[model samples]
Target: MTRSVETTSSEDSELSLPAPKERRRLREAAELTHDEIAAAVGVTAATVRSWESGRTAPRGRKRELYTQFLARLAARRQDGGPAGPPGEAKTARAAEEPAADPPVPDPPTGDTPTPDPPASDRPTPDTPASDRPTPDTPASDAPSPDARTEPEQLPAEPPARVPVPGPAEAFDALYALAARDLARQAYLLTGRGALALEAVEKAFVQAWDRWPEVATDPDPVGWVRAIAYEYALSPWHRFRRAHRQLDKPPAEPADRILLDALLALAPANRRTVLLYDGVGLDLPDTAAETEATTPTAGHRLVHAHADLADRIPELADVPLEKQSALLRDLFTALRPAVDLEPRPAAVVRGGGERRTRLWTRATLSLTAMIAVSTSYTLMTAPTHYEPPPAPGESVSGVPPLAGPQQLTERGKQLHDKLRADPEAGPARIAPRIE
Candidate 1:
């Protein structure tokens, strides 16, 4: 009687109540473990449990993350249709049932009158069966040895099932965009063309595997570019035997003078500058991705430009403000250059700039002009023609303009600036070039 009286008195003055409605909302949205939610929100699992149970409440970003988590979960469920959660009885039931599609009609009885063909094919009683081939065969059709003449023996092995791509094959185009962007950025970052290509390819392959999430991201390429940079800077890359700085100078091209300037800075500054310059990420985004300050990113870009001027004296002629613009154009052109690398069918889009098609048309136009000139020349003088013999050795047609040497040259320019800058002249500078 005393315990009941105390419980009733406490209930009358209730101030703190458990948030059961909020907990139920979260629970219905996803099958998140308490630990996972807590870890994401920087809280303990016990705290998460208390919150979920309405014994406590989370606030700020923690709450926001939870809400996002639920939203993402809901999106995934909606995509998969109204089956209960995956692996549940409802899902299993749907899997077991045949899909209601490709409707089949009842077979017609032989006694039913058949409809005649249209006016063009109106065959009367006077028409003969011999005038046309039977329904089972066309005029050119024939039963091969492996056909219905006999029960054919099975092959030694069944052919492997190749995956059929769906009509929605634009994933490859999206992937190529990400790869091209990452490759250009990586090239600017490492000043090593091959490494940049490899890094971008790896990142793109990973992105392709998670195309669904990537498709929804506003800046998929930006996400990939950041991930690629991180991959290049990972422990295996940084602390391993391959940790030496790029030793050789990049090949040179006259037109690539401006790009050759930007690729000249130290790796850190290279990344910061390139993230802003190459990928078109804003200063804050660059800093966030690179784990640097906005001011630091700005400084890095300034230092990068200065270094570019130092190494490539010609770059000094270009105004500092114009250097950024020049670098942007250089990278824009280089994107297509690296994209020349062979990629899977899924990775090429039909609608983008068709270089081959354009080239073919241009070639044909030039050939027509040459043909007209040759015809007139032949009429003026009877010329004896002797064709040169083909060379014995095979040559790869104009060995793909060896990875933009100009970008690397620009990189060296920045490196030189770092060496000369009084502020960067600290212990970081070494006389012995790596």
Candidate 2:
């Protein structure tokens, strides 16, 4: 009597999953590097390498996700699309190039070339050529004849020209240049791609609101990066963590363990390590951003380094100066996989203002109510009634007469005694009263 064996379709599918090496081959064929595939699969590059080396394999949902991602990547590659995160290659290219100035419109030209304006009336070199009034315009349109004649007296000191890059333009330029890098840093801080992008967008919105101040600052990128870091570390994110699902599958145990160790440090220590080691901020700058003294920031960094070294002994051999670069590379390789669309500037600003106003109003109302209640209680409360002192008695706990009649009689007696003893000594009156 032999028992027949039965297997469900799901079991069969699980059994038929590709070997770890095969998976790696598929990913490589799709033009995806270990880090790229790791990001797509929400695991560390080490885990991807482990998979390729057949030392470990993804299981359950992660295995399914890895398969799906590879398939999609292969399809995209076949279609001749770039095989990495959107804008990633472009951002890298842009960083390699010189800072790009905003595009200026070409100056309008007529059939004939116009001669340059006179030296005295010539526009400054910094001014865009298009902004200059066309010399070809009729004399009537070239400012009022009276105005030109009046300005001929002097150049009027160039109208106290403002800085060329206005706040709005400066902010736009900075956003274009630094948004990707800022988001990447945020991802390192938060270990969640969506949260990181959200934090960056929020920081940008704040920067936009205060663009005049931010643009004039010595380090606007640092300012925005600090904001993103603080936003990523907000406690509110913990509550949202469970609800915020990643598009990519869960990370491997080693990756998860490493992230847990990093996060287990105190917030200050974690922030110090991330900024100093991961983001390459100097102690003073990190201190300024974290609102600590440089010495304190340094201490925090040391402790953080020790903690990390305990978890990852490989870091112990890294040089002090190169540790930052090493940590940065590590985080970049492990960045989470997600693409985010930034909220519109207007929407973000409006929502932030609404929340601030609501909070302000609530706080003011609460304070006013407390003040009113306190005032009412103080005004209506019963007061202590201290009786008037009787004759021959001080208010300092002196015993009073038994009755009003007794007090009047005592006063009368004292008056009579004093009148009778006008020529007598005060000792005689005191003896009589006793």
Candidate 3:
């Protein structure tokens, strides 16, 4: 018996193929593991899990390859090929069954034996077993070579195994690894644990939302650190300064004095000292991060050191080489202790997009409103009027006829007349008064 197979176009396979369930079915039917499929598609097994779990879908070249792989498996099944070892049992059973009784009635047809019903019209005994279904069994009950396989029902309590980390897992790992250090850094910069925590949390949430991009970055932690630093410095947090001062934790007397002295310095000087002396960043790098010129950064650092020395006379005695080391140790001691744990992935990912969209809308609205207000003000503002020039006086462009000495003498005479008559006014004194 001949079987007809339907073929799918590459475009259809790539663009219109069913997702996780269909992919899962094809994989199970072919007795292939996720790793095997991943290797065939040139992706990680974790990526394959992501596809099967609906976390992500294959796209571009990967999608094309996955589609083609599934199509080949489907074709193999359609052509009576064994899906795997399980198929071999069915083949053996079909082979053991006796062939249908040969054409016995043909013998009565006389000498020529009626040239045995043309071979094309008769079913071939050699036809593969998969094409034939037993009458006692329903087609659905018996697994068909062409039918897609369904995932087997797993036990209520599945066995424990290590799970591969997908994008979400990787992001959580990164956050867990970096959050505490980032928070501590922010705390050192802002001098308030709560504000520092808030900044670090916000930056991490943003990182989580854009994990695919962040995961591929050369220094994802540094990117998040920069964001956290900027967040701590935002003007919106200034109102919290009084509260922070009230809630400041007590420190060793020396450390306390040092911190107070550091805080007293100008913000630029303080930041330069912290980034260069405390954090051990090079001058150029510190300057770039702080948005200052190298020369300006050097000036700030030098002034900061001088100011600190002036505040604590003991610092003046410390050698130049050891001063940076001392400051680094002092800053390290000042960093607030941070107890950090990985935040819920969903929560971290959810709020960032909403916040971004709201911020964008608000900014656009504010800009448009400001533009309109400015245009209206410029258009409606009253124009200044200048009185017509005195009849004998020249306009601004003409040079004065009188020499400087003559003008000076005339001015003196006018001043003397005004002094002699306390109430003398320009209108009364002028010869051309109407």
In the range 1-434, model 1's lDDT, one tens digit per residue, is 00101123223222222255645444444545677666665556666676666644443234455556555554555665753542352322243467686564554467986576467555567789766446778434744323644675886988899997653465666664556555656665655556666676566666655667877775666667767887665546645444445524434453244455554557788777666655545455667778888788788888887887676554567777456544554555443233335355354333222544687899999999999999998899847877989879867866565674555888999989877877664556556566
- Tell me which residue pairs clash in candidate 3: none
Using lDDT as the measure, the top candidate is: 3
Q: Write the per-residue lDDT of candidate 2 for residues 117-175, one digit (tens) a residue.
A: 57877788888987687748775667753476554465456566666865556666787
Write down the worst ten-residue block by lDDT for model 2.
1-10
Off by over 4 Å in 2: 1-166, 241-258, 316-322, 340-434
| Model 1: per-residue Cα lDDT at residue 298 | 83
Checking candidate 2 for backbone clashes, the offending pairs are: none
lDDT string for model 3 (1-434, tens) is: 21111223323544566678877766776667888887787666777887887865564346667777778766656665555554332332243467795553432323654355455545568876666444577545855423434566777997789888898778768777778777766665666767777788799887876777888875676678778888877767667655345236434566556667876887678777877766555565577778999899989988989899887655777776556656655666553333434355456656676787899999999999999999999998978977887677645877767755645888899878878975567666667545
- Name the lDDT of candidate 1: 0.58
Order of candidate numbers by TM-score, starting with the best: 3, 2, 1
Reference-based TM-score of each model: 0.36, 0.40, 0.41
- What lDDT is reached at residue 102 by model 3? 52
**Candidate 2 at 266: error in angstroms?**
2.0
